[model samples]
Target chain A: MSSEGTQPLGRARPQETPAVAAPLLRRGMGNLATVAAHLVLMTWTVFVAFPFLWMVVTSFKTDQEIFFSPWRLPSALRWENFARAWTDASIGRYFLNSLIVVTGAMVLTLLCASMTAYALARFDFPGNRILYYCFLAGLMFPVFLALVPLFFVVRDLHLVGTFQGLIIVYTAYSLPFSIFFLHGFFRSLPGEVAEAAIVDGASPYRVFFDVMLPMAQPGLVAVGIFNFLGQWNQFILPLILMPNPDRYVLSQGLAFLAIQRGYESDWSALFAGLTITMLPTLIVYVFFQRRVQQGLTVGALKG
Target chain B: MHHHKYRLIIPFVLPSALIYGVFVLWPYAQALYFSLTRWRGFSRNRPFVGLDNFERMLDDRLFWNALEHNALMLVVLPSATVALSLLFSALIAQGGRGLRGAEIYRIVSFFPQVMSAVVIGVLWSFVFHPNIGVLNGFLRVIGLGSLQRTWLGDPQWVLWAIALVAVWSSVGFFMILFIAGMQSIPTDLYDAATVDGASRWRAFFGITLPLLRDHLQVAFVFMGLSALDLFALVQVMAENGGPSRAADVIARYMYDLAFNKSQFGYATAIGVVLLILSLVLSVLVVQLTQRERIEF
Candidate 1:
């Protein structure tokens, strides 16, 4: 207990702290509870890992192998499954579409949201509190609440079924959270830099853009990660706003392919398509997981 | 400074404010009005029918069916997710320092949460694919062939199946949350409890659980709201609520009405109902979970 946070991570190098290890193991249910904890942990690891491993293995199997040898690895790496998924199943198109929409939306969200957040944080205008809370209010209800009319609004703007339409919609909905998170961040930033820049006769916009925005880089990154993942994985907005089959985002495209699995049972290609849809998110999570957890946990605890 | 404030403020705020208003806020206000009318597709003529959609919900069988499922979710999803996460978190931080690789477990378990819900749904459909599914295949190998059933296709199992996936995808996120909470509780409290002859069970339920109430509140509200808005999963697993409408939920009912059926007014009404349910759920969690703060 005394060496609490100093527990060396990774493999138990109990040799480094033999004194610490012995009493810790001996104190609780002695060896039994540790064994039970390991059992629970192992069972969960298997549960989470099994489906993914199975999916990865199954993606390479031929239709025949998929049905007969469900447990077996594919006899060969059937790269055609990935090829068919990418080309024929239109997963490649969907992946590109998701990239465009998410990239555009994330940039727009950070730009507009950070500007708005900086205003709320740095200035004390007449309706500052009102505007701040107004933005935060979007966090309370689920985004789907506006779905029925949101379509009509998009259609009215003649932006329906386009990347710009979906991008703006994603940016709009993401505002509440981006603003909320960045507002806290911008508010907490040291005011000395901004004050110093202003006193040098720097224009207010100059102070914000050249001075303040760069200072808010850490906040921007956190918000960027949260919104990038959110906007990328967004399903309903794209499902509703971008109704054209050719322009469907990844999640919506996968659903289309899944449902279409009935008419054409290309099980391998379907699995490959699902894996394709999951790849970028997997890569992002693998690298930026610590940041992802921190940013999102703050959102969860607050929102 | 005061004279120049509005220059930065108005420009900084107005564009996003305008976009947010038109796209998000305006639609929210417009939905309430649309709900009270008989607004339909591509129509120039529309009659304002006060309370008609809401009243129709009283007699709508599908409405009740969907509401019942969501009500069931309101009860089931949060409890299952919270219980598993709490247990996992407690284990991760047990006695201040948990077993080796607890941190790694926390890290890997979170992968599913970051995956798009559509991917999870489509992936699990393969897993529940009856003959080719791993679930059934494992059952056969384990000599439990008779126990296998078409999970998503079974009316009795469909809702629970989706809920189970929902819990599985989410439990890790909450585990990380609770682990943070547990690790923050001073080790001295546990030491004090042990010295007072409190068993681990008593110490956990009494000291650990009580101290983690705020985290519990966050977990419940989030889990409850998600349960209420289980639109993505339900749409993926059972677009029209699955077999015999066994798995229909309010959010899906709303989406189906608006998108497929094009009964925009009635669908918007349903959306309003979903909104009200979520608000009530949040308020209820706050009221119910409120406790006196114990300063350490």
Candidate 2:
């Protein structure tokens, strides 16, 4: 190949021109490879999508059809399964409980993590590095290590089985990662902006809330999404803390449905219940795919 | 002015510190104290037993077994995930026009990351059922019927099955990390490599891997820590880590000791051991991945 003709294929620059050489024979092979790539990707996508599709299909099937022929598509849609799951399984009460706990946790996590990150980013104080490392150490501590003792602490405080108590625990658990991510974003901001505000005689609090917080909206949204998804799907903590059936979150309630076994393997209702629990996360993920991906990338790579 | 600065910092910092201290740090200290005593989770008073819990843990074969499984997972899952992610990122990064479709694949792969481990466990359980399961059905249709096995039911395969799911769920997150690292590398480096007549593989080893060291280290540490926190999957998939604790990991074993057996002191001992192991592993990883900062 001539130097000019081969440059695009050989070079790794962003401005390289697209290669458009070769006769019909080479072009046919290229087309075939492209087709094969798409075929492979589509097959794997179906594999990933199957379980979710199965759950949705079975949720609409009759109880009789659930066991004998789980593979078959439902002949008639059964919408009442959702209603029965909501009432009989007490999912409505669980939904409300989850909402309260998640909302409270989200607010607490945002306030504490944001303020701590801002302070850490802007100020040069004694024990600053040590404090930051302490937070990082928290990230490495396994959640199960805290479980045995947290039970006692919560019980002693008489917060057990209370929404506010669970919210407290959730907030504490989420703080480390939230502060870590937000601290990175805060560090990336121009130092001159805060310096300028300081020179204007603006108090640190005003500079933080009035100026910096708005600039960190993307970080806030990212951390908020993480906290929401995490708190919503939290199972073990709520399972241990909230023993009262009336206060079950969606995950704990769905798990209870599976464990009862009295339903004689009523896979339809079980699938319906799981689908209800999973829908909100799946919807949020589909809508904010870019942000979620960006968040995960930033959180992992930057740290 | 300095005192005022201290005042500003303390007010903002104290609430979080106090809550975290009382809730997390204090309880951990309490766990250490309780491990030396035999408290049945509730009593008016309990007596100190002094090293009895640690001794019991040393002799407990199941504890050793669980630790072994956790070590295996820590080695297998993160390394495989990082390797696969690096490969995928390289391919996508090189295939400029094809990157759009690759983005969609990345999104689908990441769907599993947001899912609860319980849900993934349940879904995979059905797929791996001994009979009428999709996996076996597909195998039979493809004339690989002899290779099909009961994935979760068998003791030998259960840990592998669980580990496979963990690795699959994690690859997307790490893939995104590798992509980000790739994006940050200046395009000029690759051009210089091409000009030097370096093959793609050579260029990757020389240019991409060294520059991506920081990102790889971070991913490894995070994934390693995550593998140590393996509770929900074992709880849902194997329901007490299988028929005879064959799929047991440290976290699940700790849960069983604390909740099911109600051996509070023994469970606290196990928790202490887990904490130490995680700390040591994280420190070693950080040390091994440490490098003199590249000025570039």
What's each prediction's TM-score?
Answer: 0.94, 0.86
Global lDDT scores for all candidate models: 0.83, 0.75
What is residue B10's positional error in candidate 1, in angstroms? 1.8
Weakest ten-residue segment in model 2 chain B by summed lDDT: B91-100
Q: Report how far residue A31 has shifted in candidate 2, in Å.
A: 5.8
Q: Give candidate 1 regions above 4 Å deviation.
A: A1-26, B1-3, B95-98, B291-296
Writing each residue's lDDT as its tens digit, candidate 1 over B71-148 gives 999899999999999888777666334477776777778889998888888888778879789999999999999999
Per-residue lDDT for A89-191 in model 2, tens only?
7777788899899999999999999988888877889899888777766676667777878988999999999998999989888888898888878998887
Deviation from native of the Cα of residue B175 in model 1, angstroms: 0.5
lDDT at A52, model 2: 75
Span of 10 residues, lowest total lDDT, candidate 2 chain A: A17-26
What docking class should model 2 receive? Answer: acceptable
In model 1 chain B, where is the ten-residue run with the lowest total lDDT? B287-296
Model 2 lDDT tens row, B79-114: 888887787666555444533477576677778888
Instruction: State the TM-score of the second chain for every model.
Output: 0.95, 0.90
